[model samples]
Target: MTFKLDPKMTLGYVQLRVQSLENQKAFYKLLGFTIIQESATEIIFGSGSTTPVLILTAEEDVVPRPSRTTGLFHFAILVPSREDLAHVIGNLLEIGAPISGAGDHLYSEAFYLSDSEGNGIEIYRDLPRNEWQVELDGQVNTATEPIDFQGIMALYNPERAWIGFPTGTILGHIHLNVTNLDDAISHFYLEAVGLDLMTNFMDSAFFMSAGGYHHHIAANIWQGVGAPLPPKIATGLMSFSLILSSTDELNKLKQNLLAQNVSFSEVEGDLFVKDLNNNDMIFYTQA
Candidate 1:
């Protein structure tokens, strides 16, 4: 069934746990995110906007988990422009931070990094929507190519350095490691959620999104099948929540799930479900 989705609607933000408040604060600052609010144990970072992208709370003597576990693969931060990305990349190089990887994903260019505490971070800039190539079936196609590091470096104007992320930028997407890709695709794509399938990799990986964008959610078994979920003691993803444009859309999603016999719970009027990897997800409607 075809439905209309609002492009302005997207992932709101992410709330994460951290072992040390000071270290998390300093780490985020290096990425150009400004501290908007803070308390003794909690600090919120964003682009100086009302909507925060990253929220970190200090925990007492907690241990973090390896990325292989079933938890947040990475939190994507969307930059306003390529120059903005270059500014952050230049700063990271100056500080000697080890980069995990970099790639040009046709629709966007991205650099990957990890914080001192092992939380994954993706700094990326999206190509204009009109520049994206769409297939005959209305599917968006993205190619993996070598990122132009030198070309990006040329835009690294010190005077135009990014002070903070741009407003309206958001979490963008969340990737998960699951035991069974086909099961996950069926549960999230065909049942519980209303996302359209973007691409699938034959029982190994799958990507889905709303409004025809590349992907807001993706799952893969590259880590390993039957891997244990991340322990609650770790500093990592708290949960993922999707905000629908209106109550009608929310009801439609609920009805669709019900018709497909998907199981979910209701928490404070929000539909709650877990992915095949046991990652928590909440779906609620906005006025």
Candidate 2:
């Protein structure tokens, strides 16, 4: 099906439940995000403007533990451009933040890191749309190669520092650790949500924006299989909500789910479903 997606409907921000507010704030600050608002139980950090990129809600009574629960995998952040990404990388290096991995995914270059509370964070910038290589079958190609770390660093200009993310930038994607990849894919792609399937591995699934911006949400049977879901008492991902651009898109998604015989419920206009890993995903439309 040929579908067009409204980029404006992309993810706006993510709220993470953190066990220690102090540590979470310090970690994000090192990545150059400034707190935009704060309360006794919650702190919002972003590009230092009104829009927050990440939200941390402190819950001290519950200790943190790793699980296959419906919490967060990692909230991916999109940078304005390659140089902007490089500037952030340079700043990260200056702060001595621990780097987990880096890759040249033909479509984009990305660097990964984990926060003090063990939250995964990805900083990346996409290549120009025209530069993306697609197969005859319309599948996008990505590869992991050595990135030009030094070359990117050279683009860093102290005068052109990254103050905060610009408007139109968004939470590009959300990855989750699920129990079964096929089940998760069926639930999200062919069933409840009508996002086009972008790519897949034996144990992972990727769904993308209608304009084909790689993947907006990805799930894998990696760390969260044969594991228990995160307790509501624990601090982590609460739920992920997808905003559709139009009422037609929302209805189409609902129709598709019915055709697939998928089981779900609606509450106050939001369609809710649990993936194979039991992570809750909610869908709504701006209309």
lDDT (tens digit, per residue) of candidate 2 on 1-287: 52233444576567677788888887777677778889989998766356656778887686675555545677788888888887778777776879899989888899999888777888888998889887777777767889888888889887765555544455788887655555645655544455656766443445455556678877666664554666666766755667778777666667777766777789888777665545556677754
Best by lDDT: 1
lDDT (10s digit) by residue, model 1, range 44-118: 877547566778877786778766677767878887788878877887787777788999987899999888887
TM-score of each: 0.86, 0.83
- Looking at model 2, residue 49 earns an lDDT score of 56
How many residue-pair clashes does candidate 2 contain?
3
Q: Estimate candidate 1's alpha-carbon lDDT, on a 0 to 1 scale.
A: 0.75
For each candidate, the alpha-carbon lDDT, in order, equals 0.75, 0.70
